[model samples]
Target chain A: MEVRDLNFTYPDGTLALEDVSMDVHAGEIVAIIGPNGAGKTTLLLHLNGTLRGNGVVKICGRRVEEYDVKELVKKVGLVFQDPDDQLFMPTLYDDIAFGPINLGLDEQEVRRRVEEVLSEFRLFEYRDKCPHHLSYGERKKAALAAVLAMKPEILALDEPTANLDPKSVRELITAIKKINEEGVTVIISTHNLEILPQIADRIYLMNKTVLAEGESDKILADVSLLERAGLL
Target chain B: MHQEIDKYAHNSPLCNLDPRMKVISLMTLIFSVVLLPRLELVSFALLFSIALLFVSRLPLRFALHFLKWPFMFITFFLLIMPFSIEGTPVFSVGNVIATYEGLKYGVLIALRASSAVILALIMIATTKFGTLLKALEKLKVPNALIQILMFSYRYSFTFAQEFDRMRLAARARGFNPKTSMRTLRVLGSMAGMLFVKSYERAERVFWAMRARGYDGSVRMLSELKAGRRDWAFACFIIAFAALLHLVGG
Candidate 1:
């Protein structure tokens, strides 16, 4: 995944992101870290073409704008920060199967994929429950499973551990590692700095733009850089 | 309110039955009750609906609670019918009169309404809301209308939570709604805020859907199929309703 000179301004004249760019290679886990309102999510949105910005974002050598939105979604799964927003389907199973069905997959294939992802997330028990019925941590897992069911080449998650407990956070980190092991590129935007060292190979510190990008340890150890980025 | 209904739906005996079959059974019961010439058949239809509710394992108290809202409207119809329908006068009071035919017509109307409500309760009590939406899709409902219904059902719970939070915030500030201009103004502003928030949420939800590869069509992962028991149950209901039609006529 490649983003170059990305710039975005809301219709109300607020510059959300400016000249932000980053590169995520295959099988890599990249974390975008910064304080709130620092364009982390804005940058993630551009990864899957959910928002069109004045920049170049290419996936597998093709521009995101050139690919059909539906096709782009299959290649790059984008999971929102709020599970309520992401899990809009009436039931967990439907939300998980939504992407595969939209891709015109057959019934058996969609069912298989939905079941596989649900079990992988340890959410198979809540497969028939509504999003509102599940606890916050389960809902988050279900949301992630909904995207993972699409089997995207690149997974983009926004704040995957926002409301999770410590145990849930640990479980999610392990799940992410397992997913990355399966050769799918993972890009997450989050404010949880402590867990970054364990999951992210490379980190991009952004405050309205890409302020710094380097290996996780190199960036995590830069106290002055983090302080300047408002993360400290 | 929705969560309460969903609780019963999940545990309903007919939860595993095809939603299409359940809907069709309901419509048949309703139409048969309406078309039955004799009030006896209407009563039979009501009894049949109640029986099905029992078979579905919905508690009797729950069924009565679900029917309460419609029962109130039916009660109004019953009260006004005695004054409207022209017939032989049975009793007279100051500027008020009751007639025999009017009383009979009122009872008939009450029975029909009751049967319809009972069947509706039974259907809703048995089928999951999500499954019903899928069944509506199969029944040829317009996709846009179906989507509107789906989204409203999905997000109304969230909006309720938002409203509850706002209410608590108002209360926390020592604001109590009463018959006063200040309270009215505050409530109006609350409504406006909720509308703006809901509108923004709709936009975010659309983006979420787009991110999930939704391209105008709401497809289902599981297809509905009528098995032997589903078919048998549907046929039995239809045949019984038809039998009542012929016998009652």
Candidate 2:
């Protein structure tokens, strides 16, 4: 996936993204870290044609606008920060099956994928439960599972580990790693600096724009750069 | 989340029964109760509802708790009837006169209302709200209406939780509400904030749905199927309602 000179402003004239540009290779784990009010989420939304900006976003060498919204969604599954937003269906099983069913898959395939992801996230027992009943960590996992059930080539997550306990954070990192090992390119936007080196292959320190982009060690070791981005 | 009835519904002995069957059967019973011409037949309807409540295994106190509101409402109307209708005067209070006809009419209305309410309560208390919505969908209810009901049922708890949190935050700031304009203004602003927040959340939720390939219609994983026992339960309830209607007529 590639974004070139991306610029976006909200309808209220808030300059969200300015000349933002990044490239994510297939089968890579990319992390975009920034403080509050950064444009990380805006950039992720552009990847799946959910938000249109004044730049070009190409997935698999084709411009995002060229593909139908439904087709684009199948290639890039974007998970929101709030599980309540993502899991809007009545039950967890329905939420997981939502994507696959929309993709025009058969009922048997949809059921199989739903069951597979629920078991993978250890959420099989909560299949019939609603999102409000799940714990914060479980909801987060369920949200990711809902997206993964879509079988997207690129999985973009917005703030996957905000407000999580240390244990949940660790488990989420392991889950992301497992997903990455399965060859799905992962893009996460978060300020949780603790797990970057363990999970992220590359880091982009962003504040309304990309301030620094490099290997995780190089980016994490740069104290002055991290401080400049207000991430310290 | 205040889901007392929903909690009971999930754990009730009749929870596993097909919701479509329960809805049809219980609705037929309620119609019979409402259509009964004689007040004497109401006793049978009340007894039938009580039997259903027993079979459901819901706590007696919990089932009766739902009757409190209907009782209060009926009592308010019943209070005016004794003085309004002109007939054989049973008692007199200055210009106000109580009549035996008005008293009997009030009793009949109260019995009919309470019996119907209990039967409706039994129906809802034995089926999960989501399952009930699906039953309604299968029963030829409009899709848009069913969707509205589904969202309202799901998010009412969320909004309640949000309201409680906002109230707690106000209390933490040493805010005390009383019958004053200032209190009203504070509450008004809180409600406005909640509306705005809900709107923003709705927009975000729509985008999330769009990201997951949600077009317009909603699809679910579970399908309801009525078994032999469900048919038996429905047949028995319908037969009992018909019997009551005929015997009363």
Candidate 3:
């Protein structure tokens, strides 16, 4: 996926993004690190057309602007930072089942996908639980499951590691790596520089604009540059 | 947060009763209470005492404090009745007369309302909302309707929380928004934002549903059947209501 030059403003008239541009190659994991109020969320929202902008966004080399949402929604799954926002369904099963159903899959196929992801995430035991009652880690897993159930080719996550315990972070990263290994391109926006060492090969630094993009190691090496861009 | 009524209400034996049976019992009792033009002292005593017995078994006192409002209203109605209606002047006022017809009407309405409210309260006090949905699901209520009710109830708190956060965020941002025009605009924007947010959420939830492969039917786990206890309770309530109406009449 590639963004030419994205621009957006909140309805309250905050100019959130301006001439932001980036590219995510197929089968590659891309990470965007930025500080608060840096238009990270607004940019992330634009990937799935949840938030639209001026310039072009191409998913799988196809212009996201021209792709039908019904088809695009199936190709790129957006996971928000808060599990509460994502996992709004009553049960883990239903939460996971939601995306597949909306895509108009058959019943058996939806159940199969739900069961597959539930077991994959080891959340089979929590199939019947309400998301609100789950522990934060489990809720996050359930939220991911909700998106993953759609079986999107590209997984776009916002702050996947926020508020997670160390073990949960490791587990989440491992699961994400496994999914990446399975050929699902992972695009995540987070400040966890430590995470770059494990999963991300390339890093994009955004501070109200595209400040830097390169190999992960090179990005991490420039501490002053990172700090200046609100990414350190 | 006020504890959800369902969380505490589901443990009672009354909750385990078949919804059909409970529905039947409620219908019979309400009918008897409403049809008996004169709630004889004995029938009224039986219904009130039976309801109190139910109240003792369920977590109703805390689950539904609103139940007390009816009691107060009933008392107020009874107290004011004899003073308002005109019939044989039972008592003389400075320039008005209080009559026996008012007294009879007031007490009857009070008794009927009390009995019906208590019965309904008992039903709600025992059954959790989730269990009620399960029952409805089993009874073949449209899954879509149950789902809507379930999500609405579940997310109403989230809505309030979001609204509160927005209010605080606005206040901190120096938008005091107290003047009528500003308040109206801000509130209108909030309503619009909330509607958009909720609509978007509904869309996301639909995606979540589709991802789960929900091809429409809501297949719930195996539900408890109308066992002996459910039927027994139903029978006892029906018999009691019939006996009340018969004896009172």
Residue clash pairs of candidate 2? none
* Evaluation by TM-score, superior candidate among 1 and 3: 1
Q: Lowest lDDT 10-mer window, candidate 1 chain B?
A: B1-10
Candidate number of the best TM-score: 2
Quote fnat for model 2. Answer: 0.71
The worst-scoring run of ten residues by lDDT in candidate 2 chain A lies at A83-92
Model 2, B1-249: lDDT tens digits are: 464566687778799999999999989989888888787888778877878888888888887787788889989768878888889999988989999998888887878888888888888878877678778878887877877876776677677889999999999999999999999999999999999988988888889989989887676655899999999999999999999978976
lDDT of 2 by residue, A188-229 (tens): 999988889998999999998899999999999999999999
lDDT of 3 at A128: 74
lDDT winner between candidates 2 and 3: 2
Q: Model 2: residues >4 Å from true position, as ranges?
A: B80-106, B178-180
State the displacement of the C-alpha of residue A29, model 1, in Å, after optimal TM-score superposition.
Answer: 2.0
Candidate 1, residues A1-232: lDDT per residue as tens digits? 9989999998999899999878889999999999999988888888888789998999988999899887898899888888888888788888888888988888899999998998888888888888888988898888888888889999999999998999999999999999999999999999999899999999999999989999999998999999999989
* Interface Cα RMSD, each model: 1.0, 1.2, 4.9
Model 2 - which docking category? Answer: medium
Model 1 misplaced stretches (Cα beyond 4 Å): B1-3, B10-13, B36-40, B82-106, B172-181, B223-228
Chain A vs. true chain A, TM-score per candidate? 0.98, 0.98, 0.97
lDDT of 3 by residue, A1-232 (tens): 9998788887889988889999889999999988888888788777777777788888888887787777888888888887776776556776677677777778889889999999989999988767766898998888888788888999989999999999999999999999999999999999888888898978999987899999999988998998899655
Clashes of 2: 0
